[model samples]
Target: MNTTRTVRLGLPILLLAATAGLVAAPAAEARSLPTYTCGYTLDQPQFDSVRGRECTASAGAPLIGHHWITFQMRNSGSGETWVCNSVEAALVPYYLDNKIDPDYADFERAYGRGADASVCHRLLD
Candidate 1:
């Protein structure tokens, strides 16, 4: 075949091969992390009136012995909020009815007024 015709035909085949390789390339897999939940009970009626109070966290794999985590509490009302941390886990709860971006973190909801806890942590695996 003439040089011009060969070049034109080869260019399309080259482009097609490149496109096919990209389409067939494996996608990057997403990493899955462990999740932990902290439970809370409203014992005081004065603090129980607030609606939508929750406690949550994204816990990481323990390093040396401690798992680096962020705890948050949000209360929309004028209620009370508390953080309870123990050797096993960390818990934040809305008492009077009282809430990051982390691969693994927790949250707590609040009531009455608005309350927010902002905390960030960097974890090295």
Candidate 2:
């Protein structure tokens, strides 16, 4: 051990193993769920009849208190079956009133094709 005292004790053990590998390196993933852009507002004369459908979901930001906003619907002749509704993200343009769906004349002809949205984050307590 003569090379300058082994290079000052291996340079402090190589800087403490490079700071313990950057503090165990592992942390980057926290976004429960939020990001939507649905569509479905067949302007049947703007809104006077024809089932007066409406479902233009949207959620780009603002939704961090347990999060909430899931508007889904699909009943074009009962394609299996799917109908959901949950708005709370400050409620921004979330309308899904397919004429109250009494099958509303098959959802007023083509009023139900696809209009999904999502932004939910409430993991326990």
Off by over 4 Å in 2: 1-3, 19-26, 35-114, 117-125
lDDT (10s digit) by residue, model 1, range 11-119: 9999999999999999999754433322332323343221222334445522112233333232324333433221123333323211124222233232212222222
Off by over 4 Å in 1: 39-125
Residue range with the least summed lDDT across 10 consecutive positions in model 1 = 112-121
RMSD of each: 14.0, 12.7
lDDT of 1 at 39: 38
TM per candidate: 0.34, 0.26
- lDDT tens string, model 2, 45-107? 332211112332234433212234443332233222222233323222333453464554333
Cα miss at 58, model 2 (Å)? 9.9
Clashes of 2: 0
